[model samples]
Target: MIVESATGRRTPAFDTARLRTAAERSASGVTLPAVLPATALTVSSVTLTLANRAFECALPAYACSPASLPAAMPDTGWAPEGRHGLFVRNHDLYLRARDGNETVRLTSDGAEHFAYGALSGMSLMAVPLMRSQSPRPPFGITWSPDGGQFMSTRFDERKVESFPFVEAVPQDGSWRPKLWQPRIALVGDAERGDVEAAIFDVAKRSKTVIALKDGWRLYGQVFHWSADGRSAYGLVTMAALKAIGLAEIDLATGAVRIVVQEATPKWGRFNAFIYSQPNVRILEASREVLWFSERDGWGQVYFYDLGTGKLKRKLTAGQRTVRDIIGVDEKRRHLFFTAGGTDADPDPYFIRLYSTSLDGGAARLLSPETGVHLASRVPIGNAAPGSATTAALSPDGNWIVESHSALDRPPVAVLRSARDGRVVAVLETADVSRVAASGWRAPTRVKVLSADGKTPLWGTVYFPPNMRQGQKYPVIDAVYGGPQVTNAPADYREAVVTMNPRSRASLAELGFIVVMIDGRGTPGRSKAFNNESYEVFAELELADHVAGIRQLAERFGSFDLDRVGVYGHSFGGYTSARAILAYPDFYKLAVSSAGPHNFQGFYPVEGLFPAADYGDGKNIRPNPAAVPPNYARLDLMPLAPRLKGKLILVYGEMDENALPSVTLQMADALIKANKSFDLMYLPNQTHDFFRTSAYYTQRMWDYFIEHLMREEPPADFWLEIAAPSQTTGY
Candidate 1:
C-alpha cells in the first residue's frame, strides 16, 4: 500500500519490519510497574493475599479488529439478593448463576440493530476512555433492590439508515476486504427509530414493554426501580430535543406520569444537567427522589415528592454547579457530591467534594484541596484509598478514602474520617521515581486569559528533556478540545508522563515542545463558559486555542511561534484541520486522524440549526438561516482551497465513530481543489487507533521532523512496545 498525496505522487514506502523493531526497543526500556489497587480485599473475615505486578504491553489488540467486531460482554456483578447476575453476549441477555452451573437466555430476538440495552449510535462514540475498563451495562440497566427484576431499554433501529464501510484485506492474501453496514440514525433522517423501556422478570421469565408517549425519545438509562418493584423511573425529551422531563412508569399498567418538565427557548433545548450519564437517584425509604437540573442557569440538586410528583425544594443552590453525585447515604441523610467553580481558588474548574443532608442545610466541604477531585463510593468493608485525592465515602458513611495528587506530585492514597474531613491513615503512594529516571519532565502548569481577555484558561507546557534556557524550540499543540472533555490534566496522576506511544510526553520526546490547553466551551467550568460554543461550536474553540498559543509564547521564550504544528484524534482531528485552514499563517503542519470534517455531509441531522427545531411541525422545520455559519466555515471540503500548510489526513477505513466517508469527502475536495496533501487509510482500524497508535505516532513524529524541523528521520525506524505478560495475575 502506498501513501497518496494530492499531487498524484506516492511518498516513500514505510518499512513495517524496521518500525516494529524500534518500537520493541523503546517498549523494553519502559519497565514501570502497572498500577495496582491500593487496598486489599477481605471476604467473610478472610483477608486475601495480594501482590503488585508489572507487565510490558504493546498497543491494545482491540484497535486492529474489523468494524463489525463484537466486544465481549462486561461482567455485571451478581444481583442484589440473588445468586444470578445479568450479562449480554452477542446481543442476547443472559442470566448466569454465580456458582457457574445454571445459565439461562432471556431474550432470543435480540439482534444487532434491534436489541435490549442498546444505546444510540451517536452516544457510543462519546463513551470515555476510562469507562472502557469495564463493559458498559446493556442500555444502562437498573436492577431493583430486591433483585427480582431489572429495567432497561430495547432500541429498535431496523428502519434507521445504514452506512457502509469497507474492511481492508491483507496484501499477502491472509484476509479479504469485506463491506460492513453500521446502522446510524442521523438527526434529520426520515426514519429516526424509537427506544422503549423494558422490564425483565427473572422468576417468571417474562418481559414487559412500558411504551412511552409518542413523539418523545428516551433521554438516558433507567434511573431506578421502586423498592416494591411496582414502578420504574426515567427521563425523556421531546422529539425536537427541546423540552425534557422525568417520568414514573407503573409496572402493572405501563402508565406514565410526567413528574417535572423544563424548557429553554433561547438555546432551543432543555439544559442537560450532565453529559453521558443519568444523574438521578431514588431515596426509596423517604419516598423522595434526588434529581439534577440546570433550570436556574446552574446545575444543582432538587428534591421531589415521588408520590405526589411535586417539587419539595432545591437541595443545592449557588453559582456553582454540582459536577456529580458521588454517593447517597439514605440512612445517614447525607448526600456526597462533586462541584466546580464553588471555591475561592484561582482555577474555577477545579472540582471539590461537598456533602449535604436530606433536609437541605448548608453543604459541608469534604475535599478542601485545590485541585480536581473525582469521588466514588467505597465498598462495604474495603479500606483502600480511592483512585485520586478525591474522596470516596464508605458504605457506613463514617469513613472516606482520599486519593490525593497535584500537578507535581503522584497520587498518595489515604483513609479519612468523613465527618470532619481528617486524614486517618496513609494507604499507599505512587512511586514515580522510575518515570523520573526515564527523563520524563513534568509539564509546567500555566494559566492564560481566554480570548475574552478576562476569563482564565488553564493549560500545560511540556518542554524537551535536553532543553537549553536560551534556545527556542518548535512547538506542537496537542488538543482534544471536544465539548465532552477538557484536555488539561488537573491532578498529579495525569501529570506523570509515561513512554506510552499515545501520550504527549512521547511526542515531546521527538525534539518538540508539546502543549495542551482547555479553552472556553469545554466542560468543568461555568454554564456560560461551557455554552460559549453552543451555536458557534467551530469558531469559539479554535479562537481560544489560538489565544492560548499566543499567550504561551508571550509567557515563555522557549516556544517558537513561527513553527507550530497541531494534531488530535476525533474531535481533536477536526480542530487540528481547522487550525491550519482557518489560521494558515499560524499552524505550519497538522495531522487530523478520524476527524468528522464534513459535519453537515456525514450527519445532516446534527447539522440542522435551531438545534431544538425538529419534529413534524411547520414551525420546527429546518431553517437554513438558523444554522451556524461556522459549520460551513469549519468544513474541510469547503475550506480545501484555502489550505496552505503541510496537512496529512489519516483515517481508519472502519472507524465507526467518525465514519470514513467524512475523511474521504475532505480528500476529494482537496483533490478537486488541486491542493497538495498526504492521505493514509488504515484498514480495519477503529477510532481509538489501539494497535496502530505506534505506527501513527511514528508517522506524526516523522512528519513534524521532516517539515517543522527540516530534518530527516531515521529510515525504516520502528518503535517496540512491551507486550503484557500472560503469566502474571494481578
Candidate 2:
C-alpha cells in the first residue's frame, strides 16, 4: 500500500528485492547503513501530526526562570487585552493590550526564529541580528507595563562583516553544495554589533538608552517587568566567550548587580549557560519560586526572594535533580515541578511531576506511576476549588493525562480537574478514533516491582490490534532509557509511518505483543526514580524495564519471549545494543538510532567542557558528576559478534546533537568482530531527524519492515499518503 500527503510527497511500499539491493549498495564505502536491503522486510515513511507549536499556558501562567517558579509575565510580549495570547510573528514583540484595536509591535529588527521581550515600558532594547552566533549583546526591543512606552536595543551593525549563504540547487545527489563558506559573522569585528537601543518614551516620544554604556560584555537581555510597571528588572549574560555572569540590572540607571555568579571550581570551570534552551529566561520574583544552584551536592531548588537577592529557602534540598517548574497556583499555594531521581545519587534517566505547598512542605508524588518512562502533567480549570475532586484532584491541578505506552499509545492529552486529578474534557486524542478505525489493539497499563525491591515500575502493553486474547505473540520491548529526555505517556500516535506503530505499535498491529516500560531512570515518576540513572546511563534503569518485560510476558503466556526484540533511539539505542550484547537470550532483534555509544562526544560546550566535563561549575546546579565520552567509546561493536540477535543502526550524517561519528566509530569494531547488522544514514540531516513528519515516518517504517515483523512495506507509499503539507519558507 502507498500513501500521499497533500503536497504530493510520496511513501510507496516497494518490492523486497529493491530493499535488499539498496541495503547492499549502502554497504560499499559508507560506514553505517547506507542502503535499504532486498530482504523480506519492507520499509516506508509516515507523516506525524505533532502539536509542537503551542502558546503553552492557557491561564494566568508565570514566565519564571527555568530553575524557579515565575510570578509575572514580562511586559515585552503580553497581549494586553486578554491575559493569554501567542506571538503570531517572529522578530516582533506583541502583547494583547486592554484596548481591542491593533496589536502592539515592540521591535522591527525581528527575524525568523528570533524573539521579542521588554524590561519595562520606558526602557528600550538592544538586539542582536538574525543567525548571529556572537558573544555580543542581543537587544531586540522592549515595552512598558501599560503597553504605551517602548524602547529598542541601540546598535549600528553597518561596520560588522557578514558570511553569506547563497542558496543553490543540488546538481549531484547531495545536500552539501559545490560552494560553501563557514564562520561568516552576521555582525563583523570592527565593532561587532555594538549598538544601544534608541529609547522611545510613549508620552514624550523620547529616544535614548536609560544609562549609556557603549561596549560592555553584556549580550543577553532576559525578561524584566515590574508588576506595577513603575520599575523594570533585566538579566544579561555576556554573549562573549567564557560567558559566566548573570545579574539583576536596573533598567533606569543601567546599573548591574550580580544576583548569581559563576567561577572556576576546584577541578572544573563553571562554563555553561544559565537556562535550558536559548530563549528560556530566568525571571525575578518571590513565592513558590524554584532556583537552580550548585551550592548543594546536586542541582537542587531553593525558594528565592527576588527583592533581596537572597535564597529564602531551599525547596528541594537534596542530591537529586529538579528538572522544570511546570506551574504554580499562588492562590492555592501549591507548587508543581518535575524531577528525575532521588536525594542520594540522582539518575538522569527517569522523571516525574510533584506538588507541594508553596510555604515549604513535603512533596506529593504524582507521576512515574512506577516505570522508567513517564506520565506528563495535565490540568484543567480551577477558577476556584471548593471540596470534591476526581481522577485525584480538581481540574485546576490534578489530572492523569495518560499513562506511558510501549506499542499502542504515543501520549494522551486529557483535561482533568486539578482538585482530584480526574478527567474533565480532552483537548486532544492522538488518532484514537483512527486507531479504532484501523483495527489497532489497545494496550493495558500494569505495575511491575523493581529489581531493587524498593520501588515499583510501570509499563503499557499493546496487544495485537485484532488478535484473539488466548493466542501467543512475539513481544518487542521498545524503549528509550536515558536521562535529560523522555518518552511521553501521550505524544503523537499515527503509526511510525501512516502504516506502522512505532516498534511496539507495528508489532501490535502485526499480531505480536509490544511492551514499553518506564523503568526508574525514565522521567515523570518522581524526583528519586527519574534521577536513578544520573551518574550511569544503563543497566540500573534497563534492569527495571527488562524485569517488567519478563513479568508481563510470563503472566500473559500469550507472549513469545523466545522471539523478543528491543528497539530505541539515542539512550534507547544504548539499551538495544546492551540487550543483545549483555542479555542476548532476552532479545532476538535490536535496532538503534543515533545511540550515544559514547559519552565523550556528549560533552558540554567547549567553554563549559573544562568545568562541566572533566571539570566544574561555579553557580552550576549539581553536576552529573561525569559526562560520557563520545557514544562510540562505549564500543558495543566488540560485543556484536558475540550477539545471538540481529541488529540495525540508523543515524543522520549531520546530526549536531548525536554526531554521525558515534555510529561510524562503532562500525569498525562491529566489522572486526564480524557482526551482522543493517545500517541507515541520512545525509544533510541532524540528530533526532524527526523534525518533519516525512522524516519521522520514513525512518520509523524502514526499521520495522526489516526486523520487527520480518516483512516488506512499500517503496512509493510516501508519495501516495497525501498528508497535510507543513508550511515553510516565507
All candidates' lDDT scores? Answer: 0.66, 0.47
Clashes in each model (backbone N, CA, C under 3 Å)? 20, 174
Name the candidate that leads on TM-score.
1
Error of 1 at 568 (Å): 0.8
Candidate 1's TM-score = 0.80
The positional error of residue 677 in candidate 1, measured at the CA in angstroms, is 0.7
Q: Could you give candidate 1's per-residue lDDT for residues 15-47 as a string of tens digits?
A: 334333433344345332343211222111111
lDDT by residue (tens digit), candidate 2, 12-110: 454434433432343343322233312222233211111221111111121111122222333324423234332424445444433344465444665
